[model samples]
Target chain A: MEFDMTKPVPETQPWSEKFWEGTKQGKLLIQVCKDCKSKIFYPRKFCPECWSGNLDWIEASGKAKIFTFSTAYDMVEPKFTDELPYTIAYVDLEEGIRMMTRIIECKPEDIRIDMEVEVVFQERGGYFLPYFRPVGKK
Target chain B: MSKGKIAIIGIGEVPTRNMPERTHWDIIYDTCMEAIKDSGLHKNDIEGAISVTPQAQPKIAAELSFGKLPEELGLKGCKDAVSVNAGGASTSNAIRLAEQWITSGIAKAVLVHHVTVHSTIPIPDLINFFARAGVDLQWEYPYGTTYNIIMGLMANRYMHESDCKPEEMASVVTALRSWAAKDTNSFFYGKEVPSVEKVLASALLNTPLHKRESNVLGDGGSAMVIVSAEDAKKMKRPAAYKLGDSVRYFSGTCVMRDFYKVAEGFVVTAKEAMAQAGITKEDVSLWNCYLAYPLAHPLIAELLEVAPQGMGGKYFLEGRMSFGGDIPWSSIGDAPGRGHTGSGVSTACYVETARQLMGKAGERQVKNCKYVYQNAGGGSGFNNIATIWGKEI
Candidate 1:
């Protein structure tokens, strides 16, 4: 899809800059809270579990399971109408973090709950958006 | 048992409509005049004014935010004024805050009102406005996060976790619409009440959700006069006494982060409200839970223990939520069919339920509606508040 100024894009926060930087390189990074031994995603400044600020980033395996999904057949934001019949899904990564992303390169009928999938990146307005699809597909 | 310290003595509602000719001030004037007239109290009797922030206006909207309504209506001696937003839950918030002002000796009577002017907003932009209400601007909206998409995703997951099928939910729309069609005040009153088959066949707005399966938005408003229990007896109209209520907001971006907690939120409010009222589930003769998205009604039914788990959809299918059903949203039609007035439909539900309890619901009255259970909040996430009401304090 071509870049459109009307469409929404992320305004990367200071804490989330590393995540965006990693996405630009086509790598999926999960933030780990060292104090609570927990993993975080979307980049929190403090650990949600233990409220600890000690954190680190780990590259993920890119594998996930479909937690749930739905396809927009109609009535989306006007700016997104050009890309009709697209799927939005929340996928659970191997690290056990549920992230909201889209499922691409698969028919709506083929997407099912608990379906195996992996992360792939697409360039949108100079930023890589992580989307998932059925595993083992090009 | 929790005491009934407060009661709603008066109500006014302007039927949901496109209403292009009416201005925002006209709606506020009409609703408040009807309610204040019904209240049997003059401007001096009103001590405070509360309103929900409206969504449809120009650069500056809901100008009544700073107790402007009391001033505009010449509410003499009106010392307290404030505006609040909690989405549909804002309706309940207005009433709850009124109770506070009255209890603290700050106000003898409080006027709580909500109004939205959709006529001014372009028709196409209406969906865009409602969709953005529940989404995170940075994280979610850019990825085409429309309200329908969010509701559909929640419904999609609700079906997956509860074994509710798309076909079963069709009956919910049909049953709820029947109630809406019965009331002239409802947006769907003259509109067709689609059959279960038609609902399932309606054009898909989002996967697993049909266009007919959700709610309709319109321009309208509802207002009420709430007073201390002592003053309720002086009113000509029968007051709907507050038996018990539980209100709270779990503020956050998305509930999907911990989806399981959604069930906990539903159960907590319902149980707390019922417990405070010193009543069991069997005591309520009517239910006025908000008709938010497709997922809200059934998900609430099951988790609140009103129905067995995974049986929320079946509960509606059995006609249990219809006019003669066990617990009904049909009496005066709810938000789904009645017309969602943005953040005020739940407020509208307050007016409708008070009407039912006061024996003023005419043709839409529920039999033996002595005690009613009602809920309203951010339908998709953020908050849900539950309350129980009675005919007598």
Candidate 2:
């Protein structure tokens, strides 16, 4: 059973609507702090570090390095079970914040602690979800 | 300059569940009542309460139980009640809050509880939230990068760093299984401990880290009533005093800055807590460390100088968990026995130490145990907390 890509999201808070909207634009948007100039993920209005209200939205280039990662052989969910072995990774963005993304177009064994990767957006249902691929290689 | 003195006067815990069926509310109610009962006090006696749970609406405590709260355990004349959200660190961190309130003379007694219906919630999906926060969530969660895999990454790195064999980790599983087999309260009662060969042969969730090393997703809740030393003496239940505690955050999730810093940092935290408790590692009769993976023990041991270089194995020659027994994470080989519970796992270990201290643990009790050491690791690969608890504060 492939995860029904068309399944409606069961819940969505008001603030998170922007995040969902970003996927539609094929752009990854993250909040940036004014005081400390740090990037915030998890879609929060305030910065957790300095409690800075001076925040701005910035588009990311999505180029990152795999600080560490793992490949799953089992499918706990049926949505993507057909592709039994898949790689999920912690990609350290040039911005200094590491975001979790899937490594596409690379063998599981090829994933190293410091591999360079770039974001590739895919259209999942109506949302353009961001996955990553190796920079030089296909 | 306020001296914060918070003593856990009364403790209440539900029987552990193989797969927790009840809602967070059900578990909270049960443990809260047990704690209030243990305190020999009524709901009205509680002046302040604090809680940390997976649920967002903590005021449910007041709504469910007569205009009172932390959660249905019911506290009357309450002025200060907070719902903290620090994951596994929440329970003990709640203790820190209680100490603050009591030292300020704000609340004479504070009730803190953590519970969850593990079977009901989508465990895998929820754990993926941490991933969504950092990584490209849409990509990582869809195919691979769940918390388990993230830990697998850490475990892989750890294994590469040390000579810790899979068999040594399996021995940890065997010891946990051995203890759980004896504990009617444990989920794996009567189950045979998997042999080293069996563990090695198990599915590799992450390279060199087998599936058995993780914790079984069990359900349960644990409650502790924190009070001042004077208040504890008046309480009916025997107390497990908070001798000393510390919370430290390592920089970044990556292993760059604070990763290697953990071993030395752990020793510092432990030494500080021990010094405050007026005891040394030599005085600790039992040790219940939070073993997320097999690599933590040796890494921690090496860092603490528990043994000289390359002799970390010698420290475990004689102990409750010889060679790193039943770790709490992944239950990869059931090292800590059951797989992880969100919060209660750490609290339960503390409860186990409390049981041993009170002479309540039947067969598993350590002899002449006066002090017990408890460690709680939060946001794996990032936050670490250590606390020392004893019969005397």
Candidate 3:
């Protein structure tokens, strides 16, 4: 499939390149501070908790639970207008890291706080963006 | 940060409405002059200047950055001038900066002002711009979350944890808007006070939030003058004395922030500011917690313990936050009732507080106003700058 130009094409920095590369291979990678032993998301160059550059990556299990969510009935970015009635959420991964993503394969009424979810990737240009789905969904 | 030794002697604002007719420079100049005139002082009386950093810059909120405000305002060799940014806390942070200059005798007085234009950009693009600012451009913006959507997520979690209901949210909106309806200064002035049903019927921008639930930005700007107590006495004008002060900027972006940490931030800021003011929550005559959205109604109430758990909605519904109500909230209706003046809304909150303390809030003034507790922030709720004010030093 041709990459859609209408979709948001994310650029990667040096520290976030690995996470983007992992996504291209359909692997979810997260950062952990070797200094503080704290897991980090969003691929910062330094650990937010400890401000240490001594960070390493580990493959995330992709297991998560909905911390909170909201379904957009209207008023989204122009590019995402076609995906209206979409549910956006923040989920707490099993690794104790929180990340923002869209919830696919769920209805506005069915989504509940604390509901278990899993990650899936959608390709965008040279990278894949991670989105969450209810557990066991293909 | 001063020990009630400095006070806001003058305040100014333009109407809170879409004014494509006026450039940001015009708005800034108009409001600044209004404030200087209201202060009963010559323009040269202000020797120090502090500005709240403009928002959504290079398009609408641009061109006014750096420390050029004093020069732009024609201050002759001003002693000091700088800009401060902390999201909604911008103006509050600017006020603290002014206090430092005034108390340190770096300047006889300081002018703190803000301008965030919303009319220059199209609505959708504007939403996209603010959304990108609030989240990580790489990780989160691609996921299609606007400020409204992020706030929606927060509103859901807060409502779920606290058992806040949709009807209660409407009630809170209604109460907040009534204050706006009473004040000629509010954009919503002379507009019908929205009923709870009207709020429920309003279009939904995101789950659990009607279009009216959030503080959508508008073309607005405000300014204020902070002078030493000696100046206030010489002028023989009642001033809103700066008492306690606490300003903080925590983690950036709401998704990455810890809720408990922010909750603790609120408590700590409130405690420290109140302690410095030598007062308790009971002593506060007015409360202004930047309630950018409705859930903030209950959320702030609960965080500040103004209302018991999950009862913030009921508290608003009961009219406890309205004019003549216990701890009247936002004399001129604040962001939800007044219009969100970009960064200036926080400055405007202080303006309204000063008006109430000076017995000049017009029809919307809260009676017996003495002490005011205000918290303004960016990142929705991630950061906080809480301060206390009194009628006299």
Best by lDDT, which number? 3
Q: Per-prediction TM-score, chain A only?
A: 0.93, 0.80, 0.89
Docking class of 1: medium
- Please write out the lDDT profile of model 3 over residues B214-325, one tens digit for every residue: 7756777788888987778778887898888886566776688777787778888898999999999998988876757666667788778888877888888788887667
Q: Which stretches of candidate 1 lie over 4 Å from their true place?
A: A1-5, B58-62, B123-128, B234-237, B248-251, B255-257
Error at B44, model 3, angstroms: 1.7
TM-score quality measure for candidate 3? 0.94
Compare candidates 2 and 3 on TM-score and give the better one.
3
Residue A100's lDDT within candidate 3 is: 87
B43 Cα displacement, candidate 2 (Å): 4.6
lDDT per residue, candidate 3, A1-138, as tens digits? 222227777757899999988988989999888999988887888998889999999999999999999999887766787889999899999988898888998877899999999999988777788899999987
lDDT of 1 by residue, A1-138 (tens): 222338677767788888888989989998998888898766888988898999999999999998888899887766788888998887889998887788999999899989999999988888888889899999
Give the local distance difference test score of model 2.
0.62
Q: How accurate is candidate 3 locally (lDDT)?
A: 0.81
Candidate 2's residue-wise lDDT over A1-138, tens digit each? 123433222133555567668867777777787789888765556788898778777888878887766677752344455656777666778877666667889888887778899988766556666678999765
- Model 1 compared with the native: what TM-score? 0.94
Candidate 2's displacement at residue B135, Å, is 6.6
The count of backbone overlaps in candidate 2 is 33
Which model, 1 or 2, shows the larger lDDT?
Answer: 1
